[model samples]
Target: MKLHPTSDFRGLPPAEDALVRYLCAHAEALLNAAALLGDRPAVRRTARLFEELAETRQPLTRRQHAGIRDLHRLLSLEGVDDPDSLEAACFAEIDPASPVVEEICLLTDGLASRLAALRQAEGQPFGMDLSAAA
Candidate 1:
């Protein structure tokens, strides 16, 4: 995905705009790392998912956010001997100091919090109630 400037965020509400920009940047970072990692299966999977999400050019649904988070956690750098070194190498080519891991963490955390807030605003609890089941 082509990296979009913050100005392109027009039309989206402030919060959604920020989220979209962050996700785009995250996608670009992961995709660049995937490109340098060659044909590894995990990298390929992550690249595919990021590409799909980037092409959407819209805010991610909760399920899509969860899927990407899982892929990032489980497959983004799987089997890499030293992910920091790999990230450094990739970032050197794309962005010299773009901290992929931290960005991903912040983005996922923010999204999760936003979802929780939305649920709360709608009068829904954050999680299931075991007492009801019992």
Candidate 2:
């Protein structure tokens, strides 16, 4: 017997929810990066789990490709662990984005503060898709 999608998926404040929250919290900045690079008008909703395909655990999606690139650029400019190397690496565009998120997080509280400010200035609200449909 298959469970209802929502029933199968756990709500927020759980283990999976932790990761979801982490992504959601940062998504405001990440969304700007995505909107700038991707050619689509991003709606306030459906930014994270925009599609069922994203529910799968893959390295990164094609849509997310530009976002990851732009984020690395932004994070680097923000001096995310020495912007020079980050910039040089981004021009190459060969590295994956999953690893970069934590690196940016570790840069400093200042980077986090700046990211929050940028997101606020850009007027990005809370992330829409906080969790997948189980």
Candidate 3:
């Protein structure tokens, strides 16, 4: 998929705008790395999902979040030894000092936290049962 410049997100609520921007940046970084790594097909799938969510201003479902997490895990586990070196090679096309990888990690963590908060706000207890305390 061709990388398109993301539209301005300032119109969204602050939190939503931040989340969308992060996701869009994360997707672009992934696309860049995927192109260099020749893993475009798999990464493109996950990246597109993120892009779509960002564009729609919709919160991710737990399943969708899990899917992205799983894809990330798989990517990370592709080679056991010297993962950083492998990643550096994959991202060689982009400047090594570029903050894409760091930003991607931060965004992923933030997205997970945001998703959990949303779930809690929706009254969905992830692993705790409040019924027993009642």
Which candidate leads in lDDT? 3
Which of 2 and 3 is the better model by TM-score? Answer: 3
Q: Tell me how candidate 3 scores on lDDT.
A: 0.51
Candidate 3 per-residue lDDT over residues 18-76, each given as its tens digit:
54455565665655545444355656667766655555534444444554555444344
How do the candidates rank by lDDT, highest first? 3, 1, 2
lDDT of model number 2: 0.38
lDDT of each: 0.49, 0.38, 0.51
After superposing candidate 2, which stretches have Cα over 4 Å from the reference?
A: 1-13, 41-134
Model 3: residues with Cα > 4 Å off, grouped in runs: 1-21, 32-38, 54-104, 127-134
Candidate number with the higher lDDT (2 or 3): 3
Clashing pairs in 2: none
- Give each model a TM-score: 0.39, 0.27, 0.43
lDDT of 1 at 110: 57
Steric overlap count per candidate:
0, 0, 0
Model 1: lDDT equals 0.49
Query: What's the CA error at residue 115 for candidate 2, in Å?
Result: 21
How well does candidate 1 score on lDDT at residue 32? Answer: 46
Better of 1 and 3 by lDDT: 3
